[model samples]
Target: MPGERIEGYATDPSALIERLFQQVAERSMVGLPFYRPQLPIKACAFQLLEGQLFGALLTPWMLQLMLLPGPGQRWDYRRADERLALAFPQGEILFRPGEIAPDLYYLSCSLLSPVDPALSAERAVALAENSVRLALSLPVRQTSVINTGRRALLRGALSANKG
Candidate 1:
């Protein structure tokens, strides 16, 4: 049963991850106060980036960004839940080790914990897709200092940063 596909879905990049979380739900998440039966485990945008896999995940209990080592990549395993930093195109984010199988792990940055029961599955998936896209995009440009002050200062330089 270790590799059983959930809900008859074929293998995906996070299939191992999904099975791991499914085990967790079977063990302890079913009766949690905030656990909603309507919510299903989902993975979004799980594609390789610089030889690693990055994606967003939704479980009945939490929403997170996941980073998994791709083929031939091995991680320097860290203690589960210990804070670590992982960089995406957007920026560096705090992550923690997530154990998928014995000694096999992935990293995750939680976007939401103890997921709200009121959240609908469709909306949750949308949010996960958007989160993945945002995480992989370049960081938003900082506001120009000159724009915050006097406009006449534009004479200082032709461009915002140059001034």
Candidate 2:
């Protein structure tokens, strides 16, 4: 949740997509696909969490620009299966669609585990990179809808809980 902003990239959407994929491919192990509906603001962000977890924050348009299908559709993590599971090393990755907004989603990979102290930081970085790739490559379908305000409040509550 807390990370340094990835810098030195152009703001253009096309350029961002290229750079994002490149970064993820270089640093991660599996590439996973993800989907969501459109949102008011469009952006893509990457964060290195405590040097052990890598996170990618992508908007709906970003997914579309990446040539992935299903913008303006629904996504459900419950439907994800073993094939998706294999993309992540140590099976510690997470795919969380927004509960309130329903338009935002995150793919995160954990590098270090308190319970498994033997996990290496290098392995964690690779898994995180693979997650970004897998997110762009996977297929997702539209499912349901929720109010934007409700989504925002839900996100805020979740953030508060993390804090």
Candidate 3:
């Protein structure tokens, strides 16, 4: 059983991300000025779509949007750290690959990184979740022109314009 792998995503990814980053945080990031002790490590709001699993991962050093193959997709583990442009309903997001363990790989798009010390974990989590949800959503209206509001959304901030 130790060598066997489930068809797709058998283990909770939050646990995996937490464990992976926890090691990194403790090992290489302790004295870094950007590391936020209050931010902690967490993975939240993972969603599976069209055989890809994506979610928000928070560590003391950064927050990232993590993407992994769900069921039908397979990424060459050797391609770790290679950047790829992946198509989404919204647009193509650029992802850089990394490893969770031997033969296990994931992709990450940096979100809130070097997290603001003033930012509360609750707020960071909310923003991370919202950013993922918005990133995957199709634009309500297609336009060739890039407006400030839409640009902000594409840049990972929800539109502040309420109207």
Q: Which candidate is the best by TM-score?
A: 1
Model 1 CA deviation exceeding 4 Å by range: 1-12, 142-163
lDDT of 2 by residue, 23-118 (tens): 444454133232222221122334332222233333322222111112232223432231222233333334322211132222323322221223
TM value for model 3: 0.74
Q: Score residue 93 of candidate 3 by CA lDDT.
A: 85
Off by over 4 Å in 3: 1-8, 142-163
Instruction: Return the TM-score for each candidate structure.
Output: 0.75, 0.21, 0.74
Q: How close is each model in CA RMSD to the real structure?
A: 7.1, 21.6, 11.7
The lDDT values for all models are 0.76, 0.34, 0.76
Task: Specify the poorest-scoring 10-residue window by lDDT in model 3.
Answer: 1-10
**Native-referenced Cα lDDT, model 3:** 0.76
Better of 2 and 3 by TM-score: 3
Instruction: Name every residue pair that clashes in candidate 1.
Output: none
- Per-residue lDDT tens digits of candidate 1, residues 21-106? 88889998998887878888887878877877788889998999988777566566566747987767877899887665562366
Q: Locate the minimum summed-lDDT window of 10 residues in model 2.
A: 60-69
